[model samples]
Target chain A: MASIELKDIVKIYKDRKRGTELLSIDNVSFSVDSNEFLCLLGPSGCGKSTLLNMIAGFESATSGTVSVGGKPVLGPGADRGMVFQQATLMPWLPVWENIAFSLKLAGKGAEERRAAAQPFIDMVKLTGFENHYPAELSGGMAQRVGIARALLLNFSVILMDEPFAALDAQTKLEMQEELVAIWQRHQGTVVFVTHSVDEALVLGSQIAVMTHRPGRIRELIKLDLPRPRDSTSAEFNEYKRHILALIREESALARADAATV
Target chain B: MNWLASLREQRDRLWVPVLLIVAWEIFSRSGWLPPSLLPAPSTVCRTWADWVFSIDESSQANAGRWIHDALASSVRVFVGYAIAVVSGVLLGVAIGWWRWVEKTIEPTIQMLRPVPPVSWIPLAIIWFGIANKPAIFLVFLGAFFPVLMNAIHGVKTVDRNLIRAAAMMGGREAQILRYVVLPAALPSIFAGLRIAIGSAWMLTVTAEMVAVKSGLGYVLWDSYYFLRYDLVIAAMISIGLLGFLTDWLIKLLMSRILHWQHGQTVQGRNH
Candidate 1:
């Protein structure tokens, strides 16, 4: 059974100043099999994040349904964990508290929360920094805390919206590797959103390429490349080229459409 | 080496106060102005010591009344500031969180905010009589707005994503508000609290001058009538010191609560 199903999702944003309705995601639909690492790859403003938000229940579909494990999403719940691009860990919370934040909300005692947060903290390699606040952390470390917090939620599905996009190249690569390892061990459904084709290829079992505004799924490319996929390999290059071409074509069409308007 | 660096920093900070004192001493000794009108720093210190220690009756009725006056003023400040902190934070959070509260309450508060707290003295006096009640009421009026404004701002400006993140972790509305909203708003609330403390002292003194008759402001005013400029100067210095002490106390509390913000000093970190 699919872990997440989005049936004909439509999201229209009212632009009151422009006197028009902007269709951000138009008739988008997809399904993620249990434990599948799916990436929604698109250009900026293509509603990839919007689609992820819908699945995460951070957003409501204008005219469609989103279900996780056959349960329709009513609002943001513990069944779906989300990691934001900005690593939105509460600035006032220390690393351990952030990781165990969900448990805290659930009224778990301090010791239980601390004990539960430990493994994920170790998984994210932020063990010693558990007492440090988010402000004291480096960007990469903060993002690690974000990931740990999501993992601690122990949700069946984790949604990430460009989680590593703000990091430097080295940090992004390192995080990508750590993410794959974490996901492999956890085996949970992941709906990742990103603009980077290479990032999609590295982390996703399936990459859903999306077109520009009034976003529609252009292609859902299933990648069967083996684990620890080599970025420099010919297969990786071929996939990257195909994805890049798809994005460029969409961008060109969007530009032409803008010009006509 | 770190101690030396900190001492150097301390010296840089002390320069302004030192210069001001020296300049005041020079002006008072120059005799351009009447000595009675402008007491020298040394004379003021002597009067202050007498007021505090009761070494002599140089300040007459106010001699040794320093402790009582300081305590009375501080008590009013504490009561008023405490009420302001609690109510301001609660109401601010409510206004920020609930649209109905914001619409109904915030506009009225904002309208009242522009009128000076001092301007409410006559009304406060009439309502509460010439006692601590009037002083405290004035202090509350003065201090509440800053705390309320900051708390509201803090809650409103909390990163929306953090709330979403909390909700994702099985947080109910109350849980989200407590664990997420309140903690997230602490830094801003602290900023408001600091600002309110300053206003708290200002209003306390103003209240003592007019509505109340037992604090440092009362002593200052009473001394002026007696033509005891030295006592007036002493009272002024006492108020200044107390104000500084209260502000420092607030800063200490803020640092303790917001120690998380130390390394994130890039923006919105400093009070």
Candidate 2:
């Protein structure tokens, strides 16, 4: 059975002043098996993040159902954890406190919260920086805290909305490696949304390349590469070239549609 | 040498205020206006010292009574400001987090906020007659609005993602407010507290002037009636000193609570 399912999900945003309805997600259906790292790849404004939000239960699909672990997602719950693009951390809280915030909600004591947060801190390689405030940390460090905070939930699935998109290229490469290593160890499902072709090639178990504007899945390509994917490898470049051509064709068609409008 | 370098760097800060005092003393002694009319800074200091220390009772009725009067005024500000802080924060969180609370109560509060706290004097007098009660009630009114407004702004402006994060972590609605919303809104709440403290002092003094019989403002008004300009100047200096000290205390507390805000804000440089 699929660990998470999005069946015929449609999202329509109403623009009140314009008196118009804009459909964002167009009857998109997909599922992720247990422990699968499915990268939902698409262009900007293609409602990819909107799709992840639905699975995380931050948004409701207008016309379809989202279910995780055989239960319909009525709202956000601890069963699913999410790491946002911008490292949305509490500025007042130190790294350890931010990581253990959910524990605090669970009415855990200081000792317990500290204990619960330690393993995740080590998992994200932010061990020494536990007491540092978000403002004091580098961008990559803050995002590590974000990752640690999400992992501390100990959920079945984690939703990542381009969590590494803002990192410097070198830092991004390192974090991707660390993320894969963590996933290999802990073994949980992840739905990572990204626009970067290389990021999709490196991270995803299966790549769901999406069409633009009222997005639908164009292809679901299961990756069969070895661990620690070498971007310069011939097969890796072949997949990149193929995805690039598909994207080029998609963008051209989008432009043609815009010209008609 | 390290200490000396630090003092040298801040030398102008010391000298400028000293210079102003010296110039004022010289002008006051120049006999342009009578000593009663414009007492020298030294003369005011001497009278203030007599009032505080009762050195031969130079300030007469208020001799060694400065502490008592100051404490009385401070108590009113403390009680009233505490009440305002609790009510303002609670109502603010409610209004910011819940539409029903905002729809029901916020319009009334917004309307009342614009009506100056001083204008409530007549009703304050009638409702809570001549004593600490009226003064405190006025202070409450004065301190309430800034706290209320800031708390509302703080709650409303909390990052939506933080709430979303909290919700995803199995946090209930109340848990979101307690764990997520409160912490996120705190810097702004502290901003409100600072502004409210100033209002607390102002309203306390104003209340003393009109209704209360004891405190610095009463002493100032009382001395004015007797044409004791020296004592008046001493009282003004006392108020100014106390206000500065209170503000400094709040700043110290703010730095402690908002230590994470350092190197991120423009005001971070001063600390």
Candidate 3:
């Protein structure tokens, strides 16, 4: 059985100001087996984050089902951990306290929460800055705390919504490498959403390309490329080129649709 | 040199007040105004010292009664403000968090908020019988709305994503409110409490002037009846100083409890 599944999902948002119903996701369906790192890649407004949110139970589908580990997702639960686009750490909590927040919720004592969070804190390379508040950390360091917050939960599925989209290029590359290494050690299903083709190519075991607004899965490409993916190599460039072409065609069709309307 | 430089800075800030007091003394002694009607700052200071130290009978029946009156007012402010803090925060959080609470309770509160607290004086006397109860009731009326309104705004404006983050972690609703919502809303709640504290003192004195007769406000009003304008001015100065002290104390507590906010806010950055 798949670790996470979404079948025939359709989401229509009520735009109250415009007095209209807009379709954001249309008949999208996919599943991820346990231990699969599936990246849902597309342009902005593709409803990929919406799909991820549905799986995480932050939102419900207007029609159809989202289930994890053979059970339907009714609402957000500890079974699926999520890392948001912005590092939404409580501004009032220090780094370690933020990482140990779930433990705190679980009624763990301060000593235990500190001990439990240390490994994940160290795993994310934020060892010495434990006492620094969210406001004190840089963007990259704060995002690491966010990642650690999710990773410490030991959930069956992890959903990420453009978790590193705001980082500088060097930090993004470094974080991507660190994330893959951490995922290897602590294997679980991951569904990452991103607008960057290179990011998807680098991180995903299976890349699901999504079409623009009224989003649908356009294609699913599996990568057998060796680990430590070399973006400069021919095989990597070939996959990047193909994904770029697909995105170009999708945008061209979108422009045509606009013109006709 | 460091202490000297700091003293210079302090002196710069004191000049305006010093000049105002000097001018007032000159005008009062010039006999342009009746000394009995508008005593000089020097006369007021002498009466205040006598009232505090019982050095002489210049302040008459109120001499050495300054501490008693000040404490009485402070107690009223404290009791009423405490009740306001507890109930206002509880109700405000409930209104902010649940639609049912907001719908049922908030409208009535909004209607009641506009009625002047002073206007409640007659009702307060009839209801609580012109004792500490009436004075405390008046203070509660003055302090409650600020605490309630700011708390509602604070809870309402908490980052939606933070709640989502907490919910995603399997935190139950109560846990989310206690650990997430309450802490997130605290900075705003503190802001309300500061405003409420000022109102608490104002209403306490107002109540003492009319409904009750023990605090600094009573001293001022009673001294007026005896035509001791010096004692009246002394009472006014006492209320002002006490209000300043309470506000400073709250600011100290805020800095400690919200230590995490130390470098985050624009105000914090300046300090």
Candidate 4:
């Protein structure tokens, strides 16, 4: 069964300066099966994050519906955990406390919350740094905290919006591997949004290529690659070349369309 | 040796005040200005000691009444400031959090804000009848706006993403406000508190001089009527010292609560 579903979604944003309504996402629809890792691949200005946000119930579609766990998403709820592009941790809270924020909100006592946060903290590999604030953490460590915070809530679906986009190349690669390992062990549906072709190819079991503006799903490519998918592998490169071509074609079309206008 | 090292460390903060006092004392003795009109720091100190200790009774009626007057002003400052802090923070959070609160309450608040708190002395007198109530009211009026404005700004500027994250974690609105919004807005609120405190002391003095019978401002005004400039200067110094002391106390509290901000902000970078 699908763990998450979007039906005939359309999003329109108001350009207050121009006093005009701009179409952001038009007639986007897709579903992710339980435990399926779905990567949304697109260029900047495409509503990839917007689409993920709609699933997380941070944003609502101008029309159509977003459903998770067989219920329509009215607003943001614990049922759909999200890791933002930026860590967005409560700077005032220490690592353990930030990880246990949901429990704190649920009225759990400090001891109980701390106890619960321990496993997730260890899972995210943030062991000794649990007392540290978000400001003290490096970009990669902070992102790990964000992931742990989401995972602690035990949401069946986790949505990520270019979570490692700000990290250096080395850190990003390590985090990507760690994320895949965690996903394999925990087995949850993930909707990861990214503008990177390589990131999409490296992580996604199913890659949904999106168009530039008024974002529509151009194609959904399924990957049957083996565990620990190598970026240098021939199959991975083939998938990368194909997705790159699709993105290149979309960008060319966007440029041509702009020229005419 | 330790005291010497500490004094050396404090040299940057100490030099200006020391220089000003020494120059003022020399100028007062040099007769550049009448000693009575601009009493020397030494004269003020002597008068202040007499007022506090009743040494030679030079401060006359105010001698040995210093503690009583200082306590009265301190109480008024504390009560009025406490009320302002509570009401301002609550109203501010409400104004910042809800559009309805902002739309309905903020306009009237903004309208009242620009009207000087000192101008309320007549109305304060008429309403509360030359008592502590009028002085307290004035203090509230003076301190309330800064706390309210800062609270609103702080709440409004709390990272939107943090709220979104909390909401996603199934946090109720009230819980989010308490756990997320309040802590995030604290630095701004404290900033407001500091400014409001300064205003609090100013209003207290202004009120004491006109509406209330006791306090440092009353002593200042009464001494001026008696033509006792030394006692008047002493009263001024007392008020200034009290204001500085209270502000320093707040800074200490701010440091304790917002220790998380240390090394995270530009102000905290030196340490």
Candidate 5:
């Protein structure tokens, strides 16, 4: 059975002033098996994040259903851990406390929460800076804390919504490498949202390319690159070129539609 | 460069006060204004010493009464401010977090807010009588709105993504509110508390002047009846100093609690 499933999902947002509905996601369907790293890659406003949010249970689909581990998702719960676009760590909480927030909410006592959070903190390589507040950390360090927070939840499925989009280029590359290494070691299902074709190729086992607004899955391409895939390799280039062409085609079609309007 | 450095020192900040005192003394001795209306700063100092020390009964019924009166005013301010803080935060968080609560309570509260707390003095006197109760009631009235407004703003303005992140972690509603919402709203709540403290002091003194008779305000008014301008000035200074002290205390508490926000300080580090 698939670890996660999105069956004919649709999301419509009401434009109250205009009395018209904005269709965000249209009949999107996909499934992820256990230990699959699936990247949802598209241009901005392609509803990739919306799809991720539905899986995370942050947003409800207008129609259709999302299931995790064969159980339907009712609302946000411990079964699916999510890392947001921004590092939304509690500013008042220390690094360890933020990482252990899920356990804290579960009413685990301080010692247990602290104990459970340690491995994940080490997983993210943020061991010594456990007591530092979010404000005291740099942007890259904050995102690491965010990753640790998600990992400590011990959920079978992890959803990341542009988690490294705010970081500097060098930091983004480092985080991508770290993320892949973590995913490899942990072996869990992941649905990552991104606009970068290179990022999707670097990190994903399967890439789900999506079209512009009223978003639908354009294609789901399976990648056969070996572990520690080289970005400069011919195979990687070929995949990148294909995804780039798909995105350009969508953008040109969107522009043509806009010109007619 | 050395002169500029010296000019920027703390001692330089005191020059104006010293110069003002000297000018006041010269003018008082010059006798352009009646001493009964405008006493010298030295005379005010002498009366203040006697009010505190009671060495010669210079203040008559109010001699050695400084401690008692100041304590009474501080107690009223503390009690009222405490009540405001607790209730304001609870109600504010409720109104901010829940749409139903906001729709039901917020408009009424906002309508009542613009009506000055001072206008409620007659009602306070009639309901609580001329005692600590009236003074405290007035202080509560004055302090409550600021705390409420700020708390509401803080809670309402909390990053939506943070709540989403918390909810995504399997936190129940109560857990999300207590663990996520409360801490995120604290900085704004503290801002409200600071503003409320200032109002607390102001209302306490105002209430003492009319409704009660045992604070620095009472002493100032009573000294006016006896034509002791020096004592009146001394009482005014005492109120000002006490107000400054309480505000400083609140600021100290704020800094200790919000030490996590230290790195973003604009002026850099403190010595």
Candidate 6:
């Protein structure tokens, strides 16, 4: 059974400034079961982020439906936690305060917010830096704060849009390991979007490959490989090779379409 | 050593004033101009001390009356500026947030903004009479627009993603405005406030010269009529000193509230 569902979703953006229409998502449809880590793999112009936005209720589908826990989404709610490309932590808030921001909006007392934020702070491995402001933090540290802020919400589904795309490779690898460990403990559905094939193979329980501009799903592949998946493993390389070919074909097709225009 | 370092910093700040004073004093004593026409810094200092302390009542009418005049001007600036701060911020939030509010109110305000505050003297005098009321009205006129313009900019330019993040966190519209938009808009609001306070002091003095008669401006004008140029210079110094102090007080308050901005702002970098 699906924990999250998207049915024939279409998103058309009206570019009023350009006096044109942009078809960002073209009838894309998919779902994830509870506790499934689904990586949305796509090129830069693909609608993977748009699909995630619709599921997060930060955007509306032009057609069809998005349902979480069998209930249709009308708009953004506390039930869906989003980790954006940038940390997007309020500059005014320190790490602990940012992690507890949802509780603050709920009118929780300062002591309660402080107490509640502690576990997630530890989950993100940012225990001693609770008082540091966002500007004072490194990019990876700031992204950890962003993740903790979402984790404290305890949503059944977490949506991440290339959250660690800005991190250095070493930090990214460490963060990916920490994320999978946290997910194992939390046991929630996650829809992670990234253009990185290695990232998809490393983290995803299922990978959904999307085509470029006016995006539609190209393929959906499930991973049954064991935990702590090695990138150099034959199974991992096979999945990476298949995904790379799919994306390369999609990009080449897009370029051909552009040349014709 | 710490005191010496701080003193060196102070000397770097004070050099221009010291040089200007020395040049003025030398020129005055050179018999290059009539001493009566342009009083030396020493003479002005003496009159200022007399005005402040009533030492031998040398200032005659204004002797030891410095505090009263300073307080009077401060009261006018405070009241008028308070009114401007409230109305400007409120109206600005409305204008920036809602299209209806912007359409209905913004054009008239933009039109009125260009008219000089001093030009409102006749209307202010008629409406408020020749007292603090008229003076305060002018100060309000001067301070309101800058605060309003800045508040609008602050609200309009708030990052869209913050509002989205708040919404995702269960914030309703009012809560989003209160928790997210207001905090995001605060730095810009402080910028507007700092500018408006300077305008507040300017209008207060200009109003004192015409509509009101008990502040530093009144003393300056009165001393000029009596040919007491030393007293005139002393009153000028008083206005300058008070203006500087008020602005510095606002800066102190701004820095305290905006402490989070320390690492992110240009001013913070300077510090």
Computed on C-alpha atoms, the DockQ of candidate 3 is 0.89
Q: For residues A117-144, what per-residue lDDT tens digits would candidate 1 score against the true structure?
A: 9999999998799899887788999999
Question: What is the C-alpha local distance difference test score of candidate 3?
Answer: 0.93
Worst 10 residues of 1 chain B by lDDT: B262-271
- Chain B TM-score against the true chain B, each candidate: 0.93, 0.96, 0.97, 0.96, 0.94, 0.96
- TM-scores for all candidates: the values are 0.92, 0.96, 0.97, 0.96, 0.95, 0.97
Chain A only: list TM-scores of all candidates: 0.97, 0.97, 0.97, 0.98, 0.97, 0.96
Q: Which residue runs does candidate 1 get wrong by more than 4 Å?
A: A248-261, B1-34, B266-271
| lDDT of model number 2 | 0.91
Model 5 misplaced stretches (Cα beyond 4 Å): B1-9, B265-271
What lDDT score is found at residue B147 in candidate 6?
Answer: 95
Q: Per-residue alpha-carbon lDDT of model 4 for A94-144, expressed as tens digits?
A: 999999999998889999999999999999899999899988999999999
Note the Cα lDDT for every prediction shown: 0.90, 0.91, 0.93, 0.93, 0.89, 0.90
Per-residue CA lDDT of model 3 for A48-130, tens digit only, reads: 98999999898999999999999999999887789999999999989999999999998999999999989988999998999
Q: Between the candidate structures 2 and 3, which one is better when assessed by TM-score?
A: 3
- For model 3, state the Cα shift of residue A33 in Å: 1.7
For candidate 4, list the clashing residue pairs, or say none.
none
- lDDT of residue A250 for candidate 6: 91
User: What DockQ does every candidate get?
Assistant: 0.77, 0.83, 0.89, 0.86, 0.84, 0.83
- Candidate 2: stretches off by over 4 Å: B1-10
- lDDT of each residue in B1-271, candidate 4, tens digit only: 9999999999999999999999999999999887889888988898899999999888888889999999999999999999999999999999999999999999999999999999998999999998789989999998999999999999999999999999999999999999999999999999999999999999999999999899999999999998899988888889999999999999999988998887799967764
List candidate 3 stretches off by more than 4 Å. A17-20, B1-6
Model 5 interface RMSD, one decimal: 0.9
Query: Highest DockQ among the candidates is held by which one?
Result: 3
lDDT value for model 1: 0.90
